[model samples]
Target: MQFIDLKAQYDQIERDVNERIHAVLQHGQYINGPEVRELENRLAEFVGTAHCIGAASGTGALLMAMMALGISAGDEVITSPFSFVATAETIALLGAVPVFVDIEPDTCNIDPGLIEAAITDKTKAIMAVSLFGQCADFDAINAVARRHGLPVIEDAAQSFGATYKGNPSCGLSTIGCTSFFPSKPLGCYGDGGACFTSDEILATRMREIREHGQDRRYHHPRLGINGRLDSIQAAVLLAKLPLFPHEIEKRRTIGRQYTEALAHDRIIPPVVRPHNTSVYAQLTIRVDDRDALQEALKQQDIPTAVYYPVSLHHQPVFLRPDAHLPVSDEVAAHVLSLPMHPYLSDEQIRRVTTAVLEAV
Candidate 1:
C-alpha cells in the first residue's frame, strides 16, 4: 500500500545488510575506506564503464562532472525542463545558463529533434535526464552532439538499472551520473552517487575533482569539492547490488500489469519504447483531472504520488522569462505516480488497479 516499499525490500535482505554494516563498523574507515573502492569497482563493471568515481550525492556527481568539463560562468548547457531540479540546479550553480528543451509527451524525455536549434557557441554540454526510469533517445541525442562536437551527460539517477538499445543507461553518454538515494532503483542506505565515463582523461579529472582537486595526498591541482562517498553507504550498496537485476525484472512485470489493467481506463499508462527497458522508478500515469484521481484512489486506501508538479524552467529560483515548453508544462500538470515497487504482490497490484479503474 506504500509508494516504493523499501521497508519490505529491506526485510528480504536484513541479514546481509546487517552483516555489511557490521563489517564497515569493525573496519572503522568511514572516510575513503576499502569498501568504498570495492563498491566503485563493482559499479563500474556493472555499468560497463572504464571508471566509476564515487560521490557524496547525485547532485554532487553532476556538479563534479560539469566542473571537470570546464563549464563556467557565461556558458550554456542544453537540457530538458521536465526533470528533477538537480538537473538544472547544477548548471546554475556554476553560474552557467540551462537552455531549456521540450520533452516528448509520451515518454516525458527530452526531444532530440529540437536540440540542434538550442545549440550555440556557448553551449558546453547536453544533459539528458532519464525521467521515471526510462532513458531518453541517446542515439539521436548523441548524433546531434557529435555533429556539434559536444559532450553529453546522462542523468541516469532514475534509470540506473535500465537499458537503452541494449546498452546500459549509465554507460550510453560521454559522462553518466547516477544517485544512490534510498528511493532510487539502485540505492544505498544513505545519500551516495557515482559518475561513469569511458574517457580515461575525463575520468582522471573527475576523480581528482571529487577530492578537492587533489592530484595526490594534500596536493591541490584545481578548484574542486569534497564529494567522496562514505564507507558505510558503500557497504550498504554492496549488499543491495546483488539483488538489483531480479528486482528490475519484477518492476517491469508490475509495470506491464498496470499498463494492461489500465488500458481502457481514464488514465494513460507509461509508454516504454521497443528497444528500451525501464526500471519503473515510479509507475506514473496521466489523467485530465490528476488531483481528483489521486483523491479517489486515496479514498480506497491506495497511495499515489506526483513525480513533479512543476517543470524546472518554471521553478521560481531558475525561471526563464522567455520560456515556452507546452508539452513539458502540460505533462507537469497531468502526471501522477501510483504505488510501484518490486515487492508489490499480485493482490496489491490488483487492489491498486481496481481503485484506479473505479476512480477514473
Candidate 2:
C-alpha cells in the first residue's frame, strides 16, 4: 500500500543501479563527471532535444532555465496557480511576479484560454505546468505566446514521459524542465532534474548557469548557482533509462485500470485528453467530501495524498486577495492523489479502488 513504490522499482533494477553507483565511486569525480555528460546526452536523445542540462533538482532546473532566459526583477511569469509552489517560487525567487491563471476543470492544467488575459507589458514568459502527468494544451499555449512575443517554458515536472500531438514533453517548448525527484516517472535515487532545448545558445547558458556560471574552469562570465547534478544520481538514471519505456507502458495500463474501476457518479476520474499521453505521475480524483473520504480510506489502511491543499494564490507567501482563480481553488480543495506507481499489483489496485468506491 505504498503511495509510490520506489522500493519495488529499485529491487527490480538493484544490481544495475549498484553497479552504476560503484563505477561513480571508483571514478571519484562526484560532480560534473563523465557519467553526468553521458546522462545528459542520453536524456536529450530520449526527449528528442539537441541538448539536456542535468541539474541538482527540479527546482534547480526551473531556476537555471529562467536565468538562461534572463528572467529578472520586475518581470512577470504567467503560470497556473494549482501547481506545486516550485512553479511560482522559482519566479518570485528571481524578484519576478508570478501572474496567476486558472486551470481546466477536468485536466487541472493551466487553462490556455485564460493565459492571454493575464499577460501584460511586464510579462516575460508563460510557464504552463503539465499536471497529473498529462501535458497542457501546448499548441494553444504556444500560439498565444507567439502572438505576444513571449517565450513559453513547459513545467513538465509531472509529465516527463508524456506526449502532446506526437511530440515529447520536454522538447515542445522554448525551454522544458522536468524533475528526477524519486517520485517522478523518470527519477533517480535522489534529487535530480534536467532542462531540455534545441537552442544551442540557451543550452550553453543553462549548462553554465548550473555550475556557477563558469564558461571554462575559473573563467567566470555570469552569476549562477551550484545546481549541477551529482555523478551518482546520473549513474542511477542511466541504469534506469533502458527500462523506462516499459515502465511507462505499465503506468498507462495501471491508469486505465484505475479509471475503469473507479467509475461512479460520485468519483471524478482524471481525464486524459485525446492526442495526449499521461505518465500518471499521480492518479488524482475529485470528490465533494475530500477530507472525509481521505479519512475513511485511511481507516481502511489505504494511503492517499493531497497533491496541493491550497492554490498558489492562497499561500501565505504569495497570497493575492484580488486574484480570481475559482477553478484552481475548487480543484485544490477537492483533489486527492491515490497510490500510483508502475509496480502496483492488480490486487493492490483493486483493494485501493474498492476502498475508494465504498468511501465515496
Candidate 3:
C-alpha cells in the first residue's frame, strides 16, 4: 500500500482543484492574487489566530518567523534534536546556534523540562516542534519562555490540525508556522505554508519578511527572502480548506483503528496526550528491530518510512561531540511511520496493520 494515499485524496477533490486552477489561470494574477489573501484569511480563522501570512514553504514560514523575531548571529534558538532538520537548519541558516534539547520518549516532542538548562544569556526564543501530529506541552514550554521573557515559535508543520488543551496547534505559541506540503494534514497541491500570530506588529513584520522586507512595492526596509507562497498554491489550498475538518476526523478515526489493531503486537503504537487530538500526519510506531521489521513489511508489499534515521546532533552537518541527546538518538533508531492519510481505506489500514503484526 502507499505510504500516504495522495492519489485517493486528489481524486476526491479533483473537480474542485481543477476549477480553482482554472480560475487562477484565467485571472493571470500569479503573484499576490486575491486567492492568496483568501487563503490567509481562511487559515487565520481556522487556527483562531489574528493573522496568517502565506509563505513559499514550511521552511520559508520558519525562516520568516525567525526574521521577524530578529534572530541573528550570536543568538541561540533552543529546539529538539529529534525533528526534521529544517527545524534546526532554519536557525543555523540565520547564523544562530540551535541549542539541542531531548524529546519525550512517548510523544517524541521536545522535552520542556530540559529546555531551561540549555538556556543562557544568548537564548532569544524557544522553537518547539509539534511532532507526529501531537503538540508539544506548550503550557510548560510557554511558561519557561515567559519566565525568560522570550518568545516561543511553534513548529506546527506536522500538527496543523492538532489540538492542545482545546486550542489549535498553530495558535499555541507566539508565532506558529505550518507546512502545506502534500503529505501534511491540510496540504495544498504543491509546496505551501503559513505563519500565524495574534500580534499585529509581528504579523506585519512577517508579511514584509515573506516579500523581501517590502513595506510597499519596491520599498525594502530590511533583509529578507523571496518566501511568498504562489497564488496558484493558495488557490489550491483554498479549495482544500472546506474539507479539512472532515479530513481531521477521518485521520483521527484511522489512527484509533491502527492503535486498537496493533496494541497487542510487538510494535508500540503512537501515544496521544490526554488533552490533545493528533491529526495523525504520520501514524508512527516504535519497534524493537525497526530495520528488520521494515524489511519484512516491504516483503509483504507494505510500505513503511523512517521519519528520521539520525538525530540532528548526530548528523555530520550539525554534529557536536560535546552535545548528547540520548532520547532523540534512541527514538531515531526505533521509530517507523506507516501508511497514514485521511483517505486511507479500512481494507488498506487492516492490510498494513496485519503486515506489521506479522512482521513483528
Per-residue lDDT of 57 in model 2: 97
Candidate 1's C-alpha runs over 4 A off are none
Worst 10 residues of 3 by lDDT: 260-269
lDDT of 2 by residue, 261-297 (tens): 9999999998999899999999999999999999999
User: Considering summed lDDT, which 10 consecutive residues are worst modelled in model 2?
Assistant: 207-216
As a whole number from 0 to 100, the lDDT of residue 107 in candidate 3 is: 94
Question: Which candidate do you rate higher for lDDT, 2 or 3?
Answer: 2
Q: Which tens-of-lDDT digit does each residue in 107-215 have in candidate 3?
A: 9999999999999999999999999999999999999999999999999999999999999999999999999998899888789999999999999999888888999
- Give the alpha carbon lDDT tens digit for every residue of 281-359 in model 1: 9999999899999999888888888879999888899888789899999999999999998999999999998888887
TM-scores, each model vs. reference = 0.99, 0.99, 0.98
Q: Which stretches of candidate 2 lie over 4 Å from their true place?
A: none
RMSD of each: 0.8, 0.7, 0.9
Candidate 3, pairs of clashing residues: none
